[model samples]
Target: MKLQQLLSFTRKAVDEYQMIETGDKIAVGISGGKDSLTLLYALSGLRRFYPKPFELTAVTVDLGYEKFHTEKIDALCRELGVPYHVIKTDIAHILFEERKESNPCSLCAKMRKGALNEAVKKLGYNKVAYAHHKDDIVETMILSLIFEGRFHSFSPKSYLDRMGLTVIRPMMFVNEADVIGFQRKYDLPVEKSRCPVDGLTKRQYAKELIHQLELDHPGAKQRMFTAILNGRIEGWPVRLTREEVKSSS
Candidate 1:
C-alpha cells in the first residue's frame, strides 16, 4: 500500500460518496494510530491535485493519558504541512477514576467525539474525516447483528444536524490490511493508544471473529464488502457522478 494506492482508494470513496466539495474545510480526526496517520498522509497527498480543492486540518482529542505523547504526531503534521490541534480533555480520569463505569468505551467515545466536534466547529471546519475503512464497516455491521440484532453500519458520509457538520469516510474503500501496509511502507509515526480498554472492546472481538471467518471461508471478507456496497442501506446510495448525469440527460 504505497501512497498511490492509498490515494486511489481514497479518491474512489470520495467520488462515489460525493464527500468533498470545492472550498470545503475538512478536519481529520487524529487518534495517533495507523489508520488515522495513513488517512492524514492520503488526504495530504490528495490535496495536491484533487479537482475539487479542499483544505485539511489534523485534530486530536487528547484523553489526558499519562503515557500518550503527541510530539511525533505534531512533527508528522508539520511535515505534511497540515495544521494540527489537540483538544485536551480529562475524559480518561472521568471515566476511570470518577465515574468508574464498568463499560467505559462508549462513554469515552462520546466524550471524545463531543470534544472533537466542538473543537472543529470552533476552528470553522464544516466537515470531518474519520478513518473508518472497509474492515471497520463490515465488522461494525457484524457487531450490530450479533449484539443489537440489527444490520447496520456507519455511512460513508453523514451529516450531524445538531453540530451542523458533515462526516466523511474517505478511507471507506481501503482495507485494514492495506492501511497497516501503508503505515509500514511509509514509516508513519503511529502513537500507541493509551486507552486501558483499547483491545478489549466489543469491536476488537468483532475484528477477531471476522479474521477467523475469513480464514475459514476465503474471500468472505470481499463478499461481505460487496454486499455492504450494494445492500441499499440507508445513506449508502451512490451519488450520481457528473458524467452519469450528463449521460442520463
Candidate 2:
C-alpha cells in the first residue's frame, strides 16, 4: 500500500479509539519486522500533522540471538528522526538454553513485553504503539476460541494501570497483506525473526485456519472482522463514525 493509504487507515484507528493525545510521547515497539516497520513509518508520518502533537520513539528489545542484526533498522530510525533505543537481554538463552522449556513462546513473550514496557516507562513515554494489525486481531480471537475455548483478543487502546502506561494499536485497521505490500513498495528494512518457533506456533495454526476458511468462504475475513467489531468484547473500543469523532472533539 502507498504511504497515504497506510496513514489514512492508521488515522482511522487512532481517531476512532482516541489512541493519541496531546503531549503524548509514544514508544513504537519495533521488532524489525514488516508489521512493526510499517507501524514505524505510519506513526512517524502521522506525527507530521496529526494535530495532537505527539512524539515518537522507536524501541527494540534484542533477544540475545546469535545472528539477530538491526543495523538497517537503526539507520531507518535515524533517517526518520525518531530516537531509537535497543534493550539488550539474554531472553533467547534463558528460554532455550537455561530453562529448555518445551513451550517457550509464552515465557519469551512475557519477558519481551516486560522488557519493552520497562524500557518505555524509563524513557518517560506515556503510551506505546504496538504493530498488531487487523489480521492479528482476528487471528488472536480465533486462537483464543480454538485453543482456550473462549472469545478474546487484544484491545485497540488498553491502559496498564500497574505500569501507568497505555498501549495503542494504531495499525489495527491495516491488513497484513497491505503491510507486506507497503514494506515491499517502500523497501522497508525488514529483518527476519530469529525465534526458534517463528512459524511453528499456535498462532500460525490459527492464521492458516483463517486463510482456509476465507478460501472456502469468500468475504469470510471481512465478515469475521465485522463480527469482532460488533461482538462487544470487553476492552475492545467502540469504533466511532467520522461525524461522531468530529462532534465529540
Candidate 3:
C-alpha cells in the first residue's frame, strides 16, 4: 500500500509537470538526507521498469561540516549504479568566519544552491532536480506570506532563464512523513551530520509549529497541500485573450 501510494504520487507529478523527457539526462542533488535519499530511490524504482529511455545521475555537495562525511553516500550510490559527483566547498566556514552573520542557514543555503547549480551546468547535465517535498512547499509558502509579504510558492516546474537551466522538484507532491516512513521501511542508510545551528534555526521552529497546528486542526496539512494542487493560492493573474490585453495596454 505504501509503495503504491509513493509511486503513484511520484508518477503523477512527473507526467503532469513534464520534469523529464525521453532523452533528458537528469542530475539529482542528494544531500545524504532522507528526503534526497527517498527521491533518488523513487527515481531508481521508476527507472528500473520504466519503458522510456532516460538517464539519472547523483550529485552531492559537501558543505564542509567536517563532521559531515560522504563515504557512506558514495557507497550507496555505487550500489545503485548511479554515477555520483561530490563537490566539496567550505560553505560552513565561509558562513561562520567571513560574513559572521547571526543567521547563517539562509545564506548557507543560497551558497550551497549556487554551487550545486553551477556544478551541474559545468558537468553537462541539462536538467537538475532537488528533493523538496510537500512540507517544504507549505513551509516556504507560509514563510513567503509572513516574511516576504507574498503568498507565492515555488513552481513544480520552473526555468532559470539566466542560466538556461531547468530546476525541478520531483517530490513536490509527497510529504516528509511519507519519505521518513519509506526510509524506515527500506532501512535506508542515512548518515548523521551536525549543523552548527541545528535547533536554533527558524525553519526548525516553523516545522514544530506547523506540526502543532496540524494537531490542533486534524486536516490542516492535507488542506494546505490541496490548495497547492488545485491552484487555489497562486496569485497569478488570469491569462487573457490578445484583444483583451491589447485593449488594457
Candidate 4:
C-alpha cells in the first residue's frame, strides 16, 4: 500500500479507539522489521496534520545478539525527525545461555516488553504503539482458540494498569500483505530478525493456517476480522459507524 493508504487506515484506528490525545507522547516499538517500520512511517506522517497534536519516538530493544544492529533504523528515525533510542540488554544470553529454557518465546517476550515498558516510562511517554496488524489479530485469536480453548485476541487499545502505560495498535486495520507492499514500495530499512526461532513458533503455524483457510474459503480472513470487530471482546474500542465518524470529525 502507498503511504496515503497507510495513513488512512492508521488514522481510522487511532480515531476509533481515541488512542492519541493533545500533547501525548507515544513511543513506537521498532523491531527493524517491515511491520514496525511501516508503523513508524504511518505515525510520523500522521503527526504532521492530525487535529490532535502528538509526538513520536522510535525505540528498539537490542536483544544482545552478536549480529543484531539498529544503525539503519537510527538513520530512518533521523530521516523522520523522530528521536530514536536503543536499549541494550543481555536478554539473548539470559534466554539461550543462562536459563536455557525450552520454550523461550513466551519468557523472552515478557522480558522484552518489560524492558521496553520501563525504558518508555523513563522517557516519560504516556503510550506505546505496537506493530500488530489485521492478520496478527486474527492469527492470535486462532492461536488462543486452538491452544487454550478460548476465543480471544488483543484489544486495539489496552491499559497496563500496573505500569501506567497504554498500548495502542494503530495499524490494526492494515493487512500484512499491505505492510509488505508498503515496505517494498518505500524501500524501508527492514532488518532480518536474529532470533534463532524466528519462524518456528505457534504464531507462525497460526499464520499459515489462516493463509490456507483463506485459500480454501476465499473470504475466510475477512470474515474472521469482522467477527473480531463484533465479538464484544473486553477492552476493545466501540467501533464508530460512518455517521458517527463524520459527526465526530
Give the candidate number with the greatest lDDT. Answer: 4
- lDDT for 248 in candidate 3 is 40
Q: Count the backbone clashes (under 3 Å) in each candidate.
A: 0, 0, 0, 0
Candidate 3 wrongly placed segments (more than 4 Å): 1-4, 232-249
User: What clash pairs does model 1 have?
Assistant: none
Cα-based lDDT at residue 158, candidate 3: 72
List the candidates' TM-scores in order. 0.96, 0.98, 0.89, 0.98
- Ranked by lDDT, top first: 4, 2, 1, 3
Deviation of model 2 at 141, angstroms: 0.7
Q: What is the C-alpha RMSD of each candidate to the true structure, in Å?
A: 2.0, 0.9, 6.1, 0.9
lDDT of each: 0.91, 0.92, 0.79, 0.94
Which sections of candidate 2 miss by over 4 Å?
Answer: none
lDDT of 1 at 24: 98
Q: How far is candidate 3 from the true structure (C-alpha RMSD, Å)?
A: 6.1
Model 2 worst lDDT window (10 residues): 230-239
Stretches of candidate 1 off by over 4 Å are: 237-249
Candidate 3 residue lDDT tens string, 16-116: 66666677778899888888888888787777765556788999889887777778777778888898999999888787777777888888888888899
What digit string (tens of lDDT, one per residue) describes model 2 on residues 1-249? 999999999999999988988999999999999999999999999999887898899999999998888899999999999999999999999999999978889889899999999999999999999999999999999988888898888999999999999999999889899999999999999889998889998989988999999999998888888888888898877788889989766
